[model samples]
Target: MKKSIKISLGGLAFNIEEDAYAILEEYIESLIMHLGNTPEAKDIVGDIEARASELFIDLLSGMQTITIDMVSSVIEILGRPEQIVNGGESNGQSDKKSEEPKSTERRRLYRDGENGIIAGVASGLGIYFNIDSIVFRILFGVLLFANGLGAIVYIVMWIAVPIAVTTRQRMEMRGENINFSNLEKNVKEEFNKVKQNMEKRNVSGFFQKFFNTVGQILIAIGRVFGVIAKVIVVILAVVFISIGLIGLLATTASIFFGSTIVSLFPTFSGVTLAELIGSTFDLGSTLWIVIPLFFVLAIPLLALVFLGLRMVFRFKMRDTVVFVSVATIWIIAVTLLAFVLFFQARSFTIRETVRDKTELILESAQTSTIRLVANANILEGVDIPQKFFNLDDYSIANNNGKPMIMGKPSFFIGKSTSDSFELLILKRSRGATSQLARRSANGLSLLFELQDNSLVVDPFFTLSQGDKWRAQDVEVTLLLPEGKRVYIDRSMEPILSANQTCCMSWPDELVGRIWEMRGNKLVEIR
Candidate 1:
């Protein structure tokens, strides 16, 4: 049985057979003798020993102790001291020999830790391209200040590039041919530089320390700003996502469910919100408008959310095609919506008004009590599913599976110059031309009846079948003779124009109060 001995190689502990340890020691002694007792020699020897130790570790993966065979194999791979010395001379000769074509050496990008500030990306790039690292650093700094793209590129390079840790890696970083001679030269140069720096370290210690402290402070400030920026981005991302989602959901709901939800609120104008939007574009064209609108809003929001995640997690998604596609789609959507709105606006260029008067024959009485009430109760008995669109004025109902438009009629009361009571109906609408406007105005169906002194008017009117909304509206004015007592009902408040009411609260406070038309105004009877 062979005796096992403990040995240290390149700052690492190892168990080796007695014979293996002796062989390794002899090889190291021979290297030292050949290299001499210089600092450069020590660096080369150290690198060699470290390489050998790495090989030994790999060879003895399952074994408890390294054998002589493992040591011999490692030494053979490292080559003899004479070979290394002769190789340097041969490399010099080969450089002088122009006839001998040199093979192209593969270079790897690595951060040059020896000559770098922050990360060593610029230093590594400088070494790779045989340029001064300071130049690259200055350029990057300029780019960072100029357009902010330099920072992003620098960060990406820092994360992507590897650091040159080994002597061979350091040589490769400089685009040098990887061989024993070049590796030894690189190690020797690095040691000489290190020694020169050590000699001046005492003289520059204070300045170096001061600069290091400043660098640390700058790095700390950068980190704080980075964190703050991330927080802001995340908050913006959340907001964008919330808005996009809500808008998409609302738009989708409206499209699928029709104008049922919008119909709940009463509009001051006779036109419903859905009808107004629908007027700009037909239901088919609206699909194009809403779809594009949704994409335009939602895509950017989603992109913001993704960007936030990428920034926080340090992930890269190099999807230029997807970005371009989304941008193109958004542009298209915007263009289409603009085009539709442009034409829709022209439809309301002209306005037309049509008026008709019907004289009321009242039964002869001392004082006729004319009660104004809305005729909404007429549809209550009709077998149809009625949806109140605008308060009680407008509603939508299915008549034999066809959609019908309903509108509310507003009223204004004034004293007549004539002795008899007269009802005047004024229908107004907007269109692209005067003729179209007149046709739109004439399409409004407003019905009212006079039963003795009780005048019943429909609260809402309906447009002709298949007629698109052109802001159609109706105005009812009751021309009452002087001294005719008129009673207003509470139900007519929605359709009653408050401006014509002379500051009196319509229907609510004015209901049950008897008012006589005195000239142009209706004065309350005491």
Candidate 2:
């Protein structure tokens, strides 16, 4: 049995052997001599002693006294005083300092508060993806357009990702191996960083203090709602994953089985989405539009899926490679999409109208009232078996084995400048230029006839063969003399303008009634 002495370590009483005490005292003296008497150095030494005290207790294992071997073991774990000062290069341990240590653990994401401007979120992402932090900063600034989405994302990251405070954690954030040498180096680097920051305080003290105060307030708010925030993040992540999966599946289906899947949905004139896109754009531009459109829709969804999974599972991926590759592809897709859209928009730059006028030969002696009726057989000979698209008084139909756009003409009545009745038809369309628009408008076919006191008008106007639909529309205005009455046919209900029927409760009520033009407005003649 050896002699024992009671000593206080880390506020705990420990019985130690005389020989063990001698070695421990020598180690403490050496540490003080090597690391100067600065406050930071004293704190570091105190931490080392606290760590050693805990190790000694573990090594005792129910023994009443700490042995010389226990002291040696504690010193080895904390590293010798010379080794800590020189990064493990003292006492024949030069190999440990010289040779690089292989990383055994994956890198982790941590906020670099020491170098961060605000909560260190951008800095953490910068380290994770191996990209410059300024790039992310600019990206966040741009995202501010989406209703402050950038600020929301930054706050979320600030709360979710922990700050790296310890030497081991700092090393892990940088993907470095955790060893004695690395730990010592990390500590020294942290001290140097602090010193440099202190020196730079005079340069930007106001901004630094402002950010610090705001950061502290935000952190306090985050701490108060930490649990709730985590729950919200999990719920949002799940929702995003679901949306991403559904969108990805739909995009894949549209790309691979365009016709089969697109057939289920209603399109312009019974045409599938692919067929419509192909018809709208030329073949050379189609590929550019289609491929980039797919990626433009797909990349973000895939990223959402990956991010959700990462947050849920806490797994590591090939972050740098995946991020750079996907980001490059997304950027290219957006560029191509924007380029295609710019030129396509030029196609609809101008709008023009083609007008026609007719003098109605109504015999005032025969009747004071005129009959305005619609031609029921508007699609008379077209082989269209079913109507697939009908919107805004326009529809698509098959005209002689060719798909054609059919639009119902808008009808209105007003006072005539003269004592005779007249009809005006205006065909309007859009194209690349005024001339092209006029040509498109002229291609519209509206059939109507005036005989005796009755007017017969076709409800629908058809596009001429081989003419593309450029929003072609027909407007028929009837000018009636004062004291002259006209009976509107029920079939004209579909083409009657809503603005012209505001005096009536509904558009349908205005049809199948006799009305007279008085004071430039049509009044019902009860």
Candidate 3:
């Protein structure tokens, strides 16, 4: 047994054994010597000693006396000078002033040691906000409704806030200075909790069975959702790949016949057969002849990639770095081959480009309403903002189910003065590749007639984007007045989220295209 000392470190100090004191001094001196007898020794020495002191206390608590080896381990953790000197930025006043504040008086946000789930995030929040932690959790949980949004928010908070451990930190928790010892205590408590949990897992019978059952249930739910997500992703990928492959097949078929004929053609010079073959060799046909063969040869190689991807998924190839490297190389090679094809394909004549100019056959044959077909696949790659829309309030005009008024470009509509105006491609916020073609076609169904001497969109018209029926076109046979028998139905999402263009127009155009759902009084395309 050794006597405790009342030596002060910076400002905070507690008793220590005489032998412990000697060892601490020797360890600090060795650290100073390593840093050299320079002017910056004061700064370096103080940091190393303070860190060493904390380490020493930690070592002593864990069933052994503090040793020089423990101090060296602490030094190793602190590291040395780097591109930016880490610890020398602060001084005596900065640190001492921090310690001067009484514990409870200093305000702080910390992970709570008591009344916490993982760390003390909720407990600390409850303490700071003057509300019960349970209440905050319940509120966010209710808002998220088990959609995992609360979990995301909780995780973000955990990563952001540090746990309060020092006595000063406890005071800071009560609103005080950060206590180093308190901080360490919180950390120790956390590690202990983990240890306890591991012990629980290790124990046999009763509580173990109960916990295992709960864990299994959670894992099952996670797996189910994971499987559903994976399936959807695979389906979407297959659809996209199918589209690409169809193009590849068409390209291959064209070349196959061409190559066969080109190879089998009788090369009889100065003869009737030669003359006939020469006559058939037009520039367009000759080019088409070579292209199909190129596609056929290239198409089979794509299978290698599909096989690689399947192998990666099935065997957990991602667990090994070598597998990842090989997969990456495969991808690069495939990409380069694609580039070559694209270059080779440039010389091939294309009939599709001839028809690239939009064939707009717009006429008001019917008078009820028109339909717009928006090609939303072109807009899928973009990440839409959560709250970029100006949608605030809405009233379902003819929806069949409870309408959702939040997220994305919200729609708002109002009672028509005359009648629901003819649906038209008013204005699109964003899209690519035949952006307004669908809208122009679908929203212009002259199926709407002059109701009360005004052109209106036909009822029951569904405007779909990427196979999602975002809005339906209803024929305006009767006046859709406020509080009328309007039906709003949510089309169960059977595909990836639809990125239909922001269909906002006829705002204040009392008799033009009407979108009352987006809160537009009357939006008209200028």
Best lDDT among the predictions, by candidate number: 2
Residue pairs of candidate 1 with colliding backbone atoms: none
| TM-score, model 3 to reference | 0.23
Candidate 2 per-residue C-alpha lDDT over 1-526 given as tens digits, one digit per residue, 9 for 90 to 100: 7898999886667889999999999988877777676545665566567667778877976576889999998887766756555654554557654565566546799998767887787887788777888888888888877679998888778777899887666666888754344555667877888889898766657878798788788888888797787888898889889999999998987765655653574342354445456545534545777789889899999989988887777673336766889899999999988888787777678999988988788766657688988987776777544634565777665455456677888888767888788898999998889998899899999998876678989988887766666777899988888778889888778777877632543569888898887776678888
By summed lDDT, the worst window of 10 consecutive residues in model 1 runs over: 265-274
Model 1: lDDT of residue 341: 72
Question: What CA root-mean-square deviation does each model show from the true structure?
Answer: 14.0, 17.3, 25.6
2 or 3, greater by lDDT: 2
Residue 340 lDDT in candidate 1: 71
Q: Which parts of model 1 are misplaced by more than 4 Å? A: 1-192, 199-218, 249-253, 256-314, 376-401, 501-509
Task: List, residue by residue over 362-481, the lDDT tens digit for candidate 1.
Answer: 675564668888776757633344333333455655444344667777788877778888899999988989998899899999888877777889877878877767777889888889
- lDDT ranking, best first: 2, 1, 3
TM-score of 1: 0.57
Query: Cα lDDT of model 3 overall?
Result: 0.41
